[model samples]
Target: MEPHTGEICAHSMFESEEEELAGQAQAWKYTFAFVESLAVKSVVLLGIPDIIARHGPKATLSLSQIAAELPSEKPDVNCLFRILRFLVAKNFFRAETSGGANEVRYGLTPASKWFVKGGAAAPSVSMIAMLLMQNDVTMMAPWHHFNECVLDGGVAFEKAHGLHLWDYAAAHPDQNCLFNQAMACNANIVMKAILSKYEGFQGLNSLVDVGGGIGATLAEIVKAHPSINGISYDLPHVVAMAPHYPGVKHIGGDMFREVPSADAVFMKWIMHDWEDEDCVKILKQCRKAIPETGKVIIVDTVLNPREKTALDPSMGLVFDLAMIAHTVGGKERSEEEWKNLLKEAGFPRFNIIAIPALQSVIEAFPY
Candidate 1:
């Protein structure tokens, strides 16, 4: 049957019925990506990962078994089944049939293991970070106005909350605490990676952690090298809430104004939160804090689009989008951008120390 020019022809429009279905399926995945994150959030809040961990790494639990562990007096078995089914399909968990009845048992995968909180081995995963980003209404509200920020060229967070992120955090004590906790979770991960892979801290007499929240990173560094005096510098209100750490002193100050003098200045994940001018200002303060023999240590992501391996750039790209949506003029930068930023701050030379993690260590010298 010949069709008119304006009439629809399914076969001609697509290569095959199967191919068209595949395209539709791919589109659905894109459309429902947020749902996947919400599902993971739900599982984390429900303590599913922790429950599975108690059963040991290799053990699997049937739907009924998992439901029994829930705090709910009368948990819905079918609803739990559907959530687990979806998570299993996405590889957050693995499904295996057991016994004569062909019952499906769910087991944790490596991805889901990150959802487990306060595990015995090493540092805990990004559960706190995920909660801060996904569960907090204050943090999530800015995303609703993300499009407006793109169109109007303003920070989405300020647009939504009518205050800067730092100011907003200060006004809201609960949000501030969560923010510090999230940063501490990240600091533990970053410091572990740095201690193993970076040698910049070997000979320093003193080190200052600019924008250090609650002194987590500084405490770890001081514990590792007892001879090196550690100073944790942050905003006044933030430092007021920090607990005292042995061999680490917390100082409240603005990095743009002045930094505590040290043999070396260390900043982790700070530069990505400001524009070039502001970064230059902070970097200059770091430079002023150290002598000609001293250097500035910046632990941050150096975006490289070409490199592909176990350390993927996808996370960096995602973080860049997050900065765009949340911060005033913050973003993840390339190696070239880092070099330029350092140079603009009067650093004559710098060295990049690559680590096994997503961030790299950049050591910038004043002379």
Candidate 2:
């Protein structure tokens, strides 16, 4: 082989014009990925989905028709069209072109229907999640410190806000309320998926939702399983805000110290917020709360680490980075990592049940 020069190597890397274009497109896609999130946020805030829903379920509206309903006295049709056009490409809305002038009409896709609050279809769970997550002022600030966090080994949120996430929430009531609402929305979606397929709660006499905020999740569980006495456990401040729910009791305490005693202990989206040591401590507390026959039921993501396989785990992987950005020592763990945590926490045997949702149902038995 002939000796290779830098110019020759660089030319060989591209090989073809198509490969060069593909590489450039992929790079640009990653660079502009946040645009999609901002676009979705814009539509949600503008009540675009709700506006279209008012027309009718199967109704399609022209750009001018939709723009007419905007709150602004004079809404810019071109700007609105640009936003809708991008969303159309992403499949949030379906676009139809008609007439010689190529007039584009937009209709709600199944995905967009969820965002239509108070419409025929259910209100969006992600709408709440997105508001909290995509808030440029607070949530996005943490990402600015991502580099600092990587170098200094500290939470980006704390670095950005000068306080831990919990402390920050406590200090800011509105943000805290939004966060709780987001959690409840997420729990509602997950519980719906879980209750439909899983029967573990069928025979239980009682269940405790550790870290349950406002008792919303526990309330649903109690409603579903009338036989199971439900206890919602969380910090004093959080439980203080919870409303009265029939067949459900709200209790305040630290999970590291104690959890409410019950036939089974339940935690959703809690473990991923803490380090392994903290998780083990919480798990040990959970172990003590349950009886010999009792089990700890965990509703959280079981990460699949394989790259670009059949089942897409992009969300779980992104959540892992989110954990890094938001918490000191939190992450979405693989199945093997979960096993190690369980074993360390004194739960010798556990079964992971795949749910219809992004999170899996883990039953960790003390026996």
Candidate 3:
């Protein structure tokens, strides 16, 4: 071969090897990713943040002190010490030199601060813990037979539980209450950002929170702007036990059947819980419910593949799989997909407002 050709060939071979190594690294990383999730859950379950919070701001407590505060019989303190080691590595907590033998002194990191009890701007520790638990064996048993669900083209949760998620919730009041509380806890974090940043509710005389669980989001909106009259629309069963929130009315109904008429309809994390056709049907109902001059507010994640950010595509993909496992036909959509869905649903214009939270607000107006 010519000298120049030999150099090109060598460079090409080096590049291929580099790519292979990178691919192997990523594969290995993902294969063991479940360990990190479990570690997070262990800390949350042990109430490490709450324990640290009780110690007061910037106060560090020795492992023995922490053990004394926790229930004496349960939560083996030694085992908890091992978990705290991982948490320290993850930056959820920090270890400081206390005495000669390096006693584990626990202090919160910015990330762990949100898990602290009664802390303002704290992310829902209970909710995160619940989701992590769902990822455990009891809840994940359904997913093991996901192939059967795919073959039957049915919801995996139904296959495992002998009933749909909604049905199971209806039958088991305690589980239903837990589900709602988990959802509400998640909503609190997202709604705080929405109410603060997004001005979509401005100038709207009336609003409807379609599929709003227990009226949490709407309550926050109503509380923020007292003039905005709101309604919570959900299944009769789901809304039956919904607690009353001042300035908001609960309308127990189906979205596929009808949406209560309003100047603006708000759907937070609702559309992603259904398939495209179902979403279109719900959007059509929403379009019909709202006046021509009004709008439909959608709070969901608009997966942006092109946008370079720390948020990975895997997060959206995992949620998509989660929807497939639990809901009948739920999904997370991209910005382009949202545009197409809106256009097909007969809405002419829309606006995308990115919130600080996990979801984004998409406001669509009828022509």
Candidate 2, superposed: residue stretches over 4 Å from native: 1-15, 98-102, 124-126, 305-311
RMSD vs true structure, all candidates: 3.3, 3.0, 5.5
User: Model 3: which residue pairs collide?
Assistant: none
Q: Which ten residues in a row have the lowest lDDT in candidate 1?
A: 119-128
For model 1, residues 1-367, the per-residue Cα lDDT tens digits are 8656887866677888899999889989888878878888888889888787788877799888899899998998888888998999899999999899999988889888777774522344455464555457888788889778767778888888999899998999988988888888888878888888787789888999999989999999999999999999999989989998999999999999999999999999899999899999999888888998999999888888343437777789888877876688999999899889999999979888887778888889988
- In angstroms, the error of model 3 at 125 is 8.1
At residue 98, what lDDT does model 2 achieve? 86
- The Cα local distance difference test for each model comes to 0.85, 0.85, 0.80
| Candidate 2 lDDT by residue in tens digits, 1-367 | 9676555555668979999999999999999988887888899889888888888877788999998899998999899999998999999999988889988889999878867775646653445454545565777788889888768778899889999888888888877777788788888788888888888998999999999999888888888899989999998878888999999999998998998889999999999999999999999999999999999999988887332333467789887887877787999999899999999999999998877777888899987
Of models 2 and 3, which has the larger TM-score? 2
Candidate 1 vs 3: which has more TM-score: 1
**Candidate 3 Cα misplacement greater than 4 A, ranges:** 1-31, 73-75, 119-133, 136-138, 148-152, 305-313
